[model samples]
Every structure is written in structure tokens, then in C-alpha cells.
Target: MLAGSAIVFGGVFGFVAFKNHMIKQFFATMPKPVVAVTIAKAGLTEWRAVVPAVGTLQAVNGVDISGAMSGLVKSIAFESGQDVRKGHVLVQLDTDVEMGDLRSAQAELALARTSYDRSATLLRSNTVSVAALEKAEAELKVRQAKVAGLQAQIAKKTIAAPFDGRLGVRKVDLGQYVQPGQMVANLQDLSLMLCDFSVSQKDLGLLGIGQAVRMTTDAWPGVVFEGTVAAIEPLVDAKTGMVSVQARFPNADGNLRPGMFARIEIERPSGAPVVTVPASAVAYNLHGDAVFVVREDAGPDGKTVSKAERAVVQLGERKDGMVVIRSGISPGDVVVTSGQVKLEHGSLVSVAASDPLKTAAAGAVR
Candidate 1:
């Protein structure tokens, strides 16, 4: 048994030795890679850092017009899908009974007023008692309140647009009875639109009320709408880790509508200085972000040659095809921006006069 164990150990050791020697020989015989690449120099950039988010378009003043009083509809004063001004009557309920009540109350109020006047004069002349004058005055007030109450009831039967807006399709027909709180139609004030969007809670510090924003919609491709931030929701969404923001834009041309899908960009003020490179410079994989930095070396002919040195980089926000580098590179370093597919650590690179190193845009990153 001991001899068999020794044999197994020796076999394993020989195999390991052979594998190591072969690996060393393969590396020694490996050919160095040569590649052509575009290069860019890292530089200080200070610009607004923008975060991306998707949002929904909404109406600033929108509601479902509903009935507050139940009654048979006398008439629809406005047409469906029409523009209406504030106080424009939209729906009217039958108020013949209330009108009659109002007339009766007015007549009763007149009679009550006459009685109070007589009683008051009589009391002053010491003919009627003070209590009689008081009773007549109380009756007059009751009559007046009855008139007011009846008028209010009549007014409630007439539903008017509360603000200037475009009306939706009429839901209640003329002479159709509707119950209290039953929707008559939808009214949306479309002169101005409200857009509600959300951003990460971490980005909340970069936003504030009244900041300007540029918005785009799939409905109108290539068209941009501008607005200012109207509100920021006080709480972050627990499920999304994002905070909701609202912006308002003028719709004078009537191009924008509610419920449209929108994309928004909010350019904040200048932030701290940073370094950035073209998006093509970044090599992203499951490992992490990296770039190829061009370095100078002495070739076999004792001449300077450019080599690509693979560098792992820490990155920040990306914008407009540029990425902010947090670390692992310095200003004036030549970084391979494109054509890095055949590149590896210590690979030779060719940079022509036409492919001179590009300096990062000034104020292009923040």
C-alpha cells in the first residue's frame, strides 16, 4: 500500500512539472500583438452632470366633471370635444321646481319685510311690544335665508367649466338623468402641461425647483419641449429608490398632450473638475471598466515605439458619448479611444499624425 501511494505522488508531481515548463515555453514563443488605434489625452473638464430618467406627461389642471346634484339633465350647453372658457355652462339639470321655490321665497321675503317695518315703527311709537318687533325681524331673516337657499339649489343644477380647457366627449346626454358624483365629462386645461418624472434618490441633491429641463417625446420625434421644474416630491419611492419631480411647459401651440411618454434632460450647474474620455475608450466586461493607455518603449532597433498598456479605470457618469474617469489615469495620458479589439497589455500601437491625441472637451464633464 505504501509503494502504491508513492507511485501516485510521483506521477502527479511529474505532470505538474511538465505543465509548468510547457506554459513557460509557450509564453516565451508567443508573438506580440500590433494594433492601430485612435488616441485621446485626458484633460480637466467642468460641466453639468446630467442623469437620465423616463417620465410621463400630465395635465396641470385636469379633472372629471361630475354632477354634485342628482337630476334630469335639461340640456348640455357645450359640445363635446370643444374649447370652453371658465364659467361656461357645460350641463344643466332640470330646475323648474327650484325656480318656483325661489320665486315663492322672494314673495315671502317681501311680505316679511313689510311686516317687520310695521312692527318696528309701532314699537318705536310705543304701540306694539318690543317682543313683537323682534319676532317680525326674525321672520324676515328666515325668509331671506329661504330665498338664498333656493337660489343656491338652482345654481347647483347648472354645471359650468371651472377653468379654460378643452372638453372631452360628452358622457351625459340632454334630458338624461344623472346621479350625484356621476361623471359628465372630462375637462383638461391643456394650455400648460405638467410632466412628472422620477430620478434616483442619490441624484436628488443635483435637482431643485425651478431648474430648467429639456424634454422629448416619442409622439413628436426630434422635437424638444422646454420647461422648469415645478415641484420635487418630498419622499423617495421606497420600491424604486427614486424621487418624483414635476415640470411645467407651455402648450400654446397645442403640440403636447397629456399621457404621452417622455424623456427628460436636466442640465445642472457646473460641478467639480473631472477627467473624461470618449465612450469608445472604455472597455467594459464582467471584470470591470478598463482602457488602453499608450506608452513609449525602446524597440529592438533602439527606436521609440508606442505600446498599449491595459489600465483598469474607475468611472462616473456618462454623457453625450463621453465618460468621466474617477481614477486610474491622469491628464495628458494618451488613451486608446478606438480600435482596441486586438489590443492587450504590452501590445504595440501605431498612432499617425492624422490620429494625433485628442484633448478632452473643456467643460465637457462635471
Candidate 2:
């Protein structure tokens, strides 16, 4: 009875061991699961480094047109939003009183000149004293000065444009009384636009006059306006440690306006071709930056299969959703741009139909 019991137990244990071995063999024979990923070939791109900053748009010439003297508005020669030339008469103040004073002064000056002439002739003939001739000359000079002053006063009543520009909304009506230095309207020369921005003092060495700058404003979507660095402030702000920069963009279409907020990119000169991949391909970590390079290898069945291999890369400038690979990668290398999270060293991978890098470079809808 004991021998029969032992034989039965050995048979049961052997059967369990055989079942486990068969299960392990089945899994080992099955093909490894491949992680589906999107890939792009590393390509050469002209990498131009850029310093980014936000700025406010302004005109090359801008000012607030103001009244110089207190008077009633006689006439408004310019309409709001009018494009005007330099010296264009914009507002005319009531000058009736000034004109009247000028006429009286002119009449008095005429009489004084005649008296002076008569005095000079009499003195030459010994009919008048030299002091009388000198007194007549002095009165004539005073009258002349008074007339010139009245003319200047009348001229001040006529307000004209100081430069060629577009006028903002008129602040006063025809019959409104305006005081000295009161704002009448805003005048801005829009032929050329200026963008004022600030950059950190540490980046001051990267900026220079004539460096290409690209700008965009929310008012104009997808439109990139190009300009050049116009000027850089010599002194850096002590409190903020930033340097002010101005860029000049030609506005022949009059599209750019003052006070528009803009995003600015000061582009450096193009350098030699560098290897680049889509920004998504880079895995940033505290240890280092890295990218997954896809390589081909033979499977157990001798079929070629693609696998992901992680490569440590030194990064450079990044722009337009693409990042420069300064080292550890070269052009024409296949890189996994997406689905890298599921991959490990030597993990089998299959390329997906859609490539993000190509879509980004062409700006196409994905």
C-alpha cells in the first residue's frame, strides 16, 4: 500500500513539471511584440540661433499733436485717420483778434516810416535837428518790431503737421475751446515701424545693428514681418540688468501700427549645416539629453527587424519645433520621433505611417 501511494505522487509531480516546461517553450518560440513608432531620418538644416523677446511696436516718427495756444477751434482741416504730408494744416484756431492787431500795427509802421523819411530830408536841408531824425528812426524801429511780433502770434494759431504721418482720432471739435499744450490728436509716421524690446545683459554680445529680426503680432496671424536691428542702448538698466534694443521694419503696406504687441526673434547669421530632428524626439532628463536611433537587425528567423537604441546627444539651438543635435548623431540616421516610451535597448520597433518631423518642417496638418 505504501509503494502504490509513492508512485501516484511522483506521477502527479512529473506531470505538473512537464506542463510548466511546455508553457515556457511556447512563449520562447513566439515572436517578440514590436512597438509601433513614428520615425524620421536625421537631416542637415541651417541652424540660425535666435534670441527671443517681447516688444511693443512704434513708428519711426511719432508724436502727440497738441495745441500751442489757447483759442476756439476755427476749423479742423484733417479728418480722423487721415494720411497727411509734412506741413499739412491739421487744425486752425480762431485768429480774428490776432489778425486785427496785425493790421493796426502795420498801419502804424507805415506812418512811422513816412515820418522818418521826411525827418531825414529836413535834416539834410538844415530844416530839422539831428536829434529829431534820430527820434523818428527809433519810433520806426519800434513799430516794425511790433508788427513782426503780431505776425508771429497769428502764425501760432495755425497748427500744422510736423512730419508726414497718419493722424489718430481728433480730440477736439470745431467749436471746442482748447488750451495750450492740450492734446489735439496723435500723429504717427507709419512708413517705417520700430519695435522696442529688451534682452538680458548676458545676451548683449549676441545683438548687433543689422542683425535680422522676425516679428509676429496677434493682430496678424501666421504673418512674419522681417526687420533689422536698428539700435542698441549703450547703457544697461542697473535695476533690471537688461539692455534695450530697437528694430526697424519697413511698413510699405501700412500693416504695422504703433502700440501693437509683438513677439520678436533676433536671428543670428546662418551657420554650417547641422544634424537636426523633430523636438519631440529628444528625451530631456537630469542626467543628460538623449534620442532613440532606430537600427536594423536580423531576427531569429533571419528576417530584418528594426530596433530602438538610445543615444546620448549634445543639443544646440532649437527652432521651429526642431532641435539641433550638436553631437552623437549624424545626418541620414533614422530616429524614432514618437512612441519611444514603450521602447528599451534592442526593443523591436515598426515605423508608423505618419512622420511628425516632415509635417512640422512643411507646416502641414497632421
Candidate 3:
């Protein structure tokens, strides 16, 4: 009786296993769910290649205007923020003491000349000693030197512009006592602006003088300023490992100012064929930076179906919401721009009629 009962249980278990196998086979033959995704072809798209760097706008020539002589300010020769030429007087200090010294030196010089004439006449007649004539001649020289020294001192009291530029707000007022080398105002030659930034050592070789640079600033929204590379630092910073670069831009209207923050993009010449895709095509995760490429192949039933496959890419610079694909993907491969979250290695996908990647990237920063 025990053997017969064991046989019955074994048959029941086998029947159940066969039914489960048939059910799994039926589902395996069924079509997979299609995921709607936006796709873009990774192709040879020509874009203005650039190396991005952050920098500050500066004047080609700028300095803080200062006085050279210590004295009470007598007058101001220029208005604040006024344009001036080279040698234009910006400030004038009291020169009364210097002028008085100059007059005294002149009178003393005349006295010495007269004494020298009388002593020389006496010497010819042997009435005065030779030492007396030499003394008078030495006195004349001392007086002449004093006069010249006073004149130079008086000239320095009048501060003049070193170059053509606009003066900043006056830092000294009339009757205010200012010491030597004290700043009186600030001046800048804003006709041409210089933008200075740093670039990495790896990218330093790609830059050169006269390459076009485009810039924009938050201070002036929707406005673009252009320039050319003026200089590159010969040595890289040992600690930071960056090289300095300078660019110049014409500022005829004086729109650009020194110390303003600016974003810079230095143009790069075309070289090898590069593949690019929309920025949305890339997915960042723990595995690595990658993109999902669409593979169209025959399904089990001989029908065309798109499968999402992951491809690791080495990324280059980002420009205008487009990412440069350095490696791991071909030019003609189709990449999913959106709806990549639901994708797996073999996820069945369908291409959306309209590509939404461009719309999603309208205001995105590259």
C-alpha cells in the first residue's frame, strides 16, 4: 500500500512540471514590449571646436594715478572720469616754496658771477689771490645746480597723465595734504581690453596667438564679445598645473571693463573626423560614462526590432549642448537621446517620431 501511494505522488509532480514548461515556452514566443525613445545619429557634425576657460576682463594698460611730490593739493586739473591725453595735468600741488627757492638761486647765481668777474680782474693785476677767483667760480656752479634742482622739484608737483586714458573718481581734494607716491586717482586705457585666463598643461599646445576667442559675461546678458589670443604664458604653474593665456578685444564703446568676470572659448582648427551627439544621449552612473546605442535586428519571428545596447565613450569638450564622442562609438551609430532610464542591454525600443532632445537642450549649458 505504501509503494502505490508513493507512485501516485510522483506522477502528480511530473504533470505539474510539464504544464509549467508549456506556459514558459508560450510566453517566450510572444513579442517584447517596445520602449518609446528619442534617437539621434552619431555623425560627423562640424562644430566650432573650442577650449573653455574662465577669465577676467582687464584693460591693456591700467594703473592707479598718483602724485610724485608731497605737498598740499592746490588744484585739480581734470574732472573725475574725464578722458585725458599723455602729459595732461591731472593734479597740481602747491609750488610756492619751490618757486621762491628758484628765485633765490637765480639771484645768488648772479652775485657769484659778478664776484667771479671782479676777482678775475684783480688776479690779472695781482691784487687778489688765485684761491679767491677759484672760490667764486665754485660758488657759481653750486648756485646753478640749486636752481636746476628746484625746477625739477616744482615740475613733479604737477601730476600728469602717463598715457591716454580715462581718470577714475578723484581720491584727493583741493587743500588736502598728500604725501609722495600717494594715489590721486585711477586711470585705465579701455580702448582695448585684455582677458586673462589659465589653461591646463595638456591643452597649452593647442593654443596660439591670433586664434579667435568668444566671450560672454553675466553682467551683460545676451551680449557677446569677441577677441583674439594675444599671449600665452611660457611657464605653467607648478602647483596648479595651468598655463596663463591673454586675449585682447577692442572696446571702442567702453562696454567691457577691467575686473569683470568672463567666460572664454578659444577656437580650435579642424583636424581629424570627430563624432558627436546631443548632450542628453550620455548617461552618468557608477559603472562609467556611457551611451545607449540602438541596434535594429530581426526578432525571433523575423520582424525588425530595435534593441538598446550600452557603449562606453571617452568624452571630449562640451559645446552648445553637444558632446564630442572621443571613442567607443562609430559615426553612423544611432544613440538614444532620451528615455534611457528604462533601458537595459537588450531592451526593445521604438524611435519616437519627433526628437525631443533639441527641445530639452534649449537652455542647457554645455
Candidate 4:
């Protein structure tokens, strides 16, 4: 009985060992897939970097119209928001007082001239003493100077436009008293406009005078305005580490106004061709960036299967959700845009007909 029991126990142990060995061999002999892959072709590529900034629009020539002499406004020749030309009469102040003063000065000047002439004649004829003639001449000169001063004051009462421009809201009305230096209205030469903005010091190398620029303002959506760089500041701001720049734009229609905020963009030439891939395809690590490429090889059954292989690549600029690849990959190479996290080097894979990557799914594959 003891011999029979030992035989049965030995047979049971052998059966268990055999089953475990077969299971191990079966797993080992499983075939790795030969992945289907697309080949890359050489082509031209462009790389560009953009700098964005917010700025304000201004007129090339803007000024505030003011009174030069204190007086009541007699007549206003311009309406609010009206256009005027250089030397055009804008305001006529109450000239009654000024005119009265001018007339008095003219009469005094005539009297002085007559007295000086009589003194000269009498002195020449020996009828008047030299000291009396000298006194008369000095008094006559004083009266002439006073007349000239009054005439100048009269001219100051009339205000004229300094340049061709549009007028702002009127600050004073007809018959309103305005003091000297008081702002009567704001005027801006909108025939040409200027856009002022600042950029980082690092980007200064890319900028130059006369470079083309594009701009947009919230007030006019979907409208693009073009301009050219007019000037670059000689000095940079130390605190912000930025340099100021101004761009000029023709505004013959007078649509653009001073102090309107704008968004600016500058165009630059592109450099050498760069490899680009969808941004979603890249896997980032502390060491470097990497992507999975689908590799393929023929199997014993003469059919192809897919496998994933990790490739390290260098990155450049990013635009439109696509990143420029500097090295380690070429254009048209099949890359794993999705399912990267679950993949390892030389891992077997099954590619579904549907695009697993959100980027590729949005558009047709190139």
C-alpha cells in the first residue's frame, strides 16, 4: 500500500511540472508584430517665430488748440469733429477792446511822427535848442513803441488752425470767455497715424526700419491694417528690458483715432527647412523629447505586423499645434500621435482604422 501511494504522488507531481513548462514555452514562442510604417521624403520647410504686443495708436501730428490771449469768444468757425486746414481761422475772439486799443495807438503814433518832424525842422533852422530837439525825439520814440505793442496784442486775439487735422470735442462755445493758454479744443492730423509698441531686447536684432508690420484694433474687427516701421528708440528701458518702436500708417479716411488700443504683429523672413510633427506626438522627459515610430518587418507567415520604437528628437519652434523637429526624424515618417504612454520600445501593437490622436482625427492625414 505504501509503494502504490508513493507512485501516485510522484505521477501527480510530474504532471504539474509538465503543465508549467508548456505554459512557459508557449509564451516564449509568441510572435512579435512587424509594424506597418510610412517612409519620409525630403522637402522644403519653413520656421518662423512671432512676437506679440499691445500698443496704442496716435496721430503723426497732434495738438491741443488753445487761446493765445484772454478774451471772450466772439465767433467759433469750426464745429466739433470738423476738418480744418493750416492757417484757417478757427476762432475769432472779441476784438472790440483790442481794436479800440489799436486805434488809439495809431493816433498816438501819428502825433509822435508830426512832433518829431517839427522838432527836426526847428532845430535845423536854429529856432529850437539841441536839448529840446533831443527830448522831443525821445518822447516820440516811446509813443511809437507803445503803438507797435498794441498792434501785436490785437493779432493775438485771433486764433487759427496750425495744421490740417480733425477737431475734437469743443471745450468752449461762442461768446464764452477763455483765458490765455486754456484748451479750446483738441486737434489731430489723422492723414497719417502712428502705432507705438515695445518689444523685448532679445528680439531687437530681428527688427529694422522700414520692415512691414500688421496690426488690428478691437474697434474694427476682422480688418487688417498695414504699416511700416518708422523709428526705433535709441535707448532701451532698463527696468523692463524692452525697446520702444513706432510704425507709420496712412489714414487718409481719418478712421483711426489717437489713444485707440491695438494689437501688433511683425513679419520676418524664414530660415532653413525644419522637420515638423503634430505636437501631440511628442513625449517630453527631463533628459529630452521623444516620439514613437511605427516599424515593420516581414514574419514567417509572409504578413506584416506593427511594432513601436522610441526615437529621441531635437525640437525647434512651435506653430499651429505643430512643432518643428530639428533632428532624429524626417518629414513623412509615421509617428505615433497617440497611445504612446502605454507603449514601450519593441512593443507589439495593433493599429485601428480610426485615428486615435485628436490632432490627426481633426483633419485628413497628410
Candidate 5:
């Protein structure tokens, strides 16, 4: 019985070994998994960098109109938010009182002139004392001064536009009493607009007068306005450690208004072109950014199996959706953009083509 049991065990062991050998042979005969690859080509590349900042838009010329003389508003010539030209009458104060005063002054001046004429005649005839003639002359001069003062006051009662601009909400209506120095309305020349913003001191050297800037505002959606740097503040803000900048844009249509918030992008120069790959392809490490490049080589079966070689790159300014590479790779070299999380130096790899270029273009438009 013991001998029969040993024979059965031997037979069973041999069968198991045969099945394992067959399975290995089948796997070896099967083909390797197929992977897609994107061919790399050399092309012209543009390098640009942009700095973003929040800013406020303002009219290049803005002013607050004020009442210069206290009186009742007889009429408001301009409607709220009306556009007016320079020298156009904007407000008329009740000038009846001023006219009456002017008339009285004119009457006194006429009487003084007649007295002065008579005094001069008397002095020429030597029929009156010199002191009497001098007294008449003094009274006539005083009346003339009063007449001039009254004329000046009458002119002030009629308020005119100081410049060509659009008016804000009216602060006073017809027949309303306005005190001297009271705000009547606001006026802004919207033909040109300015954007005021600030940037970090570290970037001060990159910014200068006449640099191009692209701007967008919440008030006007999806419209990109172009401007140029108008000025840079002479001094940096000590507390915030930022330098203020002003950019100007043409607003001939009066679309941009004062106090509108905007997003500003300032462009700066980028140095010579270097080898670059998709940002996603780069793996971060304590050392630096690294990418896996596919290397083509012949396998045991005389077919090509893609292999990966680790490459270290020095990165520079990033613009649009592309990063600038300073070194490590060259143009026309294929680098892995995805599926490289577990890859190591000199590891075997399979190339997979994805729509990464399309994705990057879409991001740039946004």
C-alpha cells in the first residue's frame, strides 16, 4: 500500500510541472502590448512672460464741479449724465438780485460822473476851492469801483462748463438753494482712461514707461483692452513693498469709466529659446524638474521596445501654457507628457499619445 501511494504522488507532481512549463511558453510567444507615440518636430517657438495685477480705472481728466456763489438755482441746463462742451452753460443761479445790484451801481456811477464833470469845470474856472473839486473826484472813483465789483458778481451767477466732459448725477435741481463751494456735479473726460496698479519691488526692473499691457474689466466682459505704461511712481510704497504703475488706454467710445476694477497683464522680455516640454511631463523632485524621454532601441526579437531615459532640465519663465526650458533637452526630442508617475531612470516605457497639445491651446485662449 505504501509503494502504490508513492507512485501516485510522483505522477501528480510531474503533471503540475508540465502545466507550469506550458503556461510560461504561451506567455513568451504572445506579442507585447501596443502603445501610441507622438513624433516630435522642430518649430518656431515664441517666449513671453506676463505679470498679473488688480487695478482701478480712472479718467485721464476728471473734476468735481462746485458752486462759486451762494444763490437759488434758477435752471439746470444740463441733464444728469449729459455730455457738455467747454463754455457751455451748466447752471444758472437766480441772477435777479445780482442784476438789481448792478443797476444801482450803474446809476450811482452816472451821478458821480456828472458831479466830476462839474467839479473839473469849476476847477478850470477857479470858481470853487481845490479841496471841493478833489472831494468830488474821490466820490466818482469810489462809484466806478462799485460798478466793476457788481459786474464781476453777476458773471459768477452763471456757471459754465470748465471743460468738455460727461457730467455725473446732479447734486442740485432747479430752484434748489446751493451754498458757496457746494458740490454741483462731477465731470469726467472719458476720451482716455488710466489704470492704476502696483507690482512687487522685485519686478520693478522689468517694468518701464511705454511697455504694452493687456487689460480686462468686469464691467465689460470678454473684451481685452490694450494700453501702454504711462508712468511709474518715483518711489515704492514702504509698507507694502510695492511700486505703483499707471497705464493709459484710448476710450474714444466712452466705454471705460472711472473707478472700474480691472485686471492688468504686463509683458516682459524673455531670453533665448531653450528646449522645452509640456509642464505635465516634468516630475518634481528635491533636485529639480525632470522628464522621461523615450529612447528607441532594438529588442531580442529585432523589434523596437520604447525605453525611458531620465533627463534633468533647468526651467525659466512660464508664459501662456508653456514652460521655458533652459537646458537638458533639445528640439525634435520626444518626452513623456503623462503616465510617468512611477517611472525611474533608464526604465522601460510605452509611448501613449494624448490630446495634450489641444488642451494647452484651449487654456491659452481662456
Candidate 6:
């Protein structure tokens, strides 16, 4: 019975050994799984840091054209949306009454001048008393003042453009009565535009007069309007701790209008070299921002293979879809920009056929 039991045990042990050897051989022959991913080489680039803010565009010179005096509109001199120069007649109000008064005052002034001349001549010959000559002189001055006032009244009724600008729709029509301080139309100088925005007090030091600025508006997408820092408020807001900044942009084409919402970017005059990569490569999580770096290694079969290794990185500003990598990776390192989901710490990887950014753009169009 002992001999029979030994034989049975040996047979069972042999069977188990053969099965394990066959399984090992089968696994060794199979290929390792690899993930296909898009990658970009980290490169050194100028670190362009920008301070972003939102603001509203305003014409450098803009105002609601209003009337200084009330009268019936005799004629409209400019059409709606007309470009006008300084002192261009915009509206002419009826000035017949003032003109009539001016003529009467002028006739009185002529008589006063004659009387003053006669008084001076009489005083020279002692033909008139000193008091009488002085009284005649005062009367002549009063008449002259009356004539000037009437003439000014007539000029006030004829409203004209205060500056060179483009006019909005005409609010006053011919024969319509307009009151003093009432808006006749809107006038704006479109040759230059100004945008007022606020930035944190800490960034105030980064700003200066003539610093380069860039702006974009919903009205003109994909078009960048270049400008400069025109003015910086000397005082910071006590409540918000923000400093007001004004940028001036050239708008010779008149594309920018007053009150249009704008996105502004103030560029730093100086920059440092930094390592950069596509923005898609970053994986943000509770732990930290990390990127998958591609590395080459020898597989078990003595064949070279690419592997993905997670690396934590400190990020800086992002511009033009590329992000500045402040730490963790150096220039010339390959990073996975897309298809990172299938990767692990040492997962095998292969370069994808097409760029992920290009693919995404194409997909968006579709």
C-alpha cells in the first residue's frame, strides 16, 4: 500500500509541474499590450506672462451732441452717420428774431457812437460840461454791449460740431423744437479707442505708460487690436484694492465702438526662458497637476519599448494653447499630450499617427 501511494503522489506532482511549465511558456510568447498616444516634445520658449482683465471700449472723444439753446430746428445740416469736422454746422435753428434784435441794437450803437464823438469834440472846446461828456461816453458803451449780446444769441441758435467725429442718428428734425441741453445726436471720435479696466494692486507695479497691450471684442472676433497703457490711476480703490488702468488703441477703421465689451491682455515687457508643452498633457487632480512623460526601457525579451511615467509639475501661465511648465520636466523630454487615460506608471506606449490637437480641431468642425 505504501508503494502504491508514492506512485500516485509522484504522478500527481509531475502532472502539476508540466501544466505550470506549459502555462509559463504560453504567456512568454504573447506580446505586451501598448497604448497608442499623442506626444509632444517639451521645448524651451519665451515665457510670456500676461495679466488679463475685462473692460468696455470707449472712444477717445465721445459725447452726446446736445443743443445749448432752445429754438425751432430750421434745417438739418448733417445726415445720420456722417463724418464731421470741428465746427461743422450740424443743426440750424430759426434765428430771425435774434437777427432782428441785433439790427435794432446795431442802429442804436451807431447813434451812440455819433453822440460820443460829438461829446469828445465839445469837451475839447469846453462847449459841454465834464459830467455831460462822461455820461455820453457811458451811453455809447452800453449800446455797444447790447449789440454784442444780440449777435451772440443768434450764433447760439446755430449748433455745430464740437470736434471731429462720426455722428450717430440725428435726433432733431427740421422744424422740430429742441430744448436747451437736449441731445441732438451722439458723436464719437473713432480714430482712437480707450478701454478702462482694473487690475489687482499687486500688478500695478507691472504697468507703465506705453506698455504693450492687446484687446479683443465680441464685435470683432479673431482680430487683435494692439494698444498701449495710456494711464494708470495713482490711487487704488479702498474697497476693492484694485487699480484702474486705461489702454489706448488705434481704431482708424472705426471697428471698435463705445461701450463694447472687451477682453484685455497686458503683456509683460520682459520674459524668461521656460519649458513648455501642449495644454492637453496636464491632468489636474486633488493631489496635484501631473504629466505623463514618455521614457524608453528594455522589455523582458531584450526589446526596447516606450513607457509612460507620471511626473508632478508646477505650471505657470498658459498662452496660445501651450502651457509653461515651471518644474518637474526639462526641455527635450517627450510628454503625452493625449490618450493618457490608458496609461499607467510603466505602461507600454506608441506614438499615435496624428496629432491630438489637430484631431480635436477637425472634430469640432464636424
Judging by lDDT against the true structure, name the best candidate. 2
Report the candidate with higher lDDT, 2 versus 6.
2
Provide the lDDT at 63 for model 2. Answer: 98
Greater-lDDT candidate between 2 and 5: 2
- What candidate 2 gets wrong by more than 4 Å, as runs, is 1-32, 126-129, 200-208, 238-241, 300-302, 354-366
Clashing pairs in 2: none
Report every candidate's CA lDDT. Answer: 0.86, 0.89, 0.87, 0.80, 0.80, 0.88
What is the lDDT, from 0 to 100, of the residue 360 in candidate 5?
A: 43
Q: Evaluate residue 222 in candidate 4 and report its C-alpha lDDT on the 0 to 100 scale.
A: 90
What does the lDDT come to for candidate 2? 0.89
TM-score of 5: 0.73
lDDT of 4 by residue, 102-127 (tens): 88878887888898889899998999
| Worst ten in a row by lDDT for model 2 | 357-366
Best by TM-score, which number? 6
Model 3 worst lDDT window (10 residues): 357-366
Off by over 4 Å in 4: 1-43, 48-52, 129-137, 278-314, 319-322, 335-366
Q: Write the per-residue lDDT of candidate 1 for residues 18-95, one digit (tens) a residue.
A: 999999999998866678787877767774776677888878799999978999998888888999999999889999
Backbone clash count for every predicted candidate, in the order shown: 0, 0, 0, 4, 0, 0
- The RMSD (Cα, Å) of candidate 2 is 4.9
Give the per-residue lDDT digits (tens) of candidate 6, residues 114-174.
9999999999999999999889999999999999888888889988899999999989887
Model 3, span 321-360: residue lDDT tens: 8888889898777889889999988899988853655534
Candidate 5 per-residue lDDT, tens place, 18-38, comes to 999999999989765434444
Q: What TM-score fits each model?
A: 0.75, 0.82, 0.79, 0.72, 0.73, 0.84
What's the candidate order when arranged by decreasing TM-score? 6, 2, 3, 1, 5, 4
